[model samples]
Target: MKNLLSLLTIAFLSTGVFAQTTWKADKAHSQVSFGITHMTISEVEGLFNEFDATIEASEEDFSDAKYTVEIEVPSIDTGVEMRDNHLRNADFFDAEKYPKMTFVSTSSEKVGEGKYKVTGDLTFHGVTRPVTLDVWHRGTVKDQKGNLISGFAISGEVKRSDFNLGPDFPEAVLSDKVVIDVDAEFKKA
Candidate 1:
């Protein structure tokens, strides 16, 4: 009985130590942006200004990192206010019905030095799809408050039609594929 208790104590301590390295998103320093082909020659780009993410990363190695991110769809901004307003309508994001989109990590593995492949379930427009992002660690530093800060950039592409945003635009003007970029900073929590 004493041996079993000792083992349990060690296990609990190890879990606590592992969790201490977690970092939460610094919303002011992070942004999620997306771009889609418009007219096959031009691109339309937009960004979500309000979002949050939680990251668990190892200071010694980035492969042990994990992330979960949430984005507010209504916060999207394009260069033109009219275009941005249109995108928030039912024809596009339908922010009134689905105010947010989320991505939760399923797996994270290192592909090369400071580079990784992160697989997750991405939910958008009430549909969920498994997606993979090419992630790169931009390094870590100390903030003004002396908290550890880490930066990462990830990119992926998803088919907009898969999420039921298919019939909104004419096929000639819009493509189904949309590319997403995530540039995030995390502070040790």
Candidate 2:
């Protein structure tokens, strides 16, 4: 009886140490987008039509969460086909040379209720740079299909010159700062 009790205790403790939840981005409900100043007169927005994101967490509040995202460089769309094509060319992203942009979180710290500061390495245009982004947990819910879903909003900024993107264009032509916004829904996996 003592041996059986010891074995049960170990099993319970092991589960706590090894258990983690994985969440996959629901593509139908998620968006990866960005905005940048155009000619220093107005802002132009664009989005990547194809991307993948995943999160792994052990804590319920996601204080120990890790995130990863990959975006197809050629999938950029800016409502104007000409501009989109330009963005994918050598003058901008050079999609033929760098086909994928990715990000991986290095640390996450909870700042307030449902809010966190996530620092990660963002790789774009063949350049990798560390960036810090603000993240908001919109909450979690169960869908009619009995699947658990969680929503998150992420916002940050990156400099065009940092990655040598559109190097030929001056700040007046294409603002150096590019703003990023992501709204994503993850289904428990």
Q: Which candidate has the top score in TM-score?
A: 2
TM-score of 1: 0.87
List per-prediction Cα lDDT, in the order shown: 0.86, 0.96
Residue 154, model 2: lDDT of 98
The residue ranges of model 2 lying beyond 4 angstroms of the native Cα positions read: 3-7, 13-18
- Give the worst 10-residue stretch by lDDT in candidate 1: 56-65
Clashing pairs in 2: none
Please state every model's RMSD to the true fold in angstroms: 3.0, 1.5
Candidate 1 lDDT tens digits, 89-109: 998889999998999998888
TM-score of each: 0.87, 0.95
Residue-level lDDT of model 2, residues 1-189, one tens digit each, is 999999999999988976799999999999999999988899999999999999999887888999999999999999999999999999999999999999999999999999999999999898999999999999999999999999999999999999999999999889999999999999999
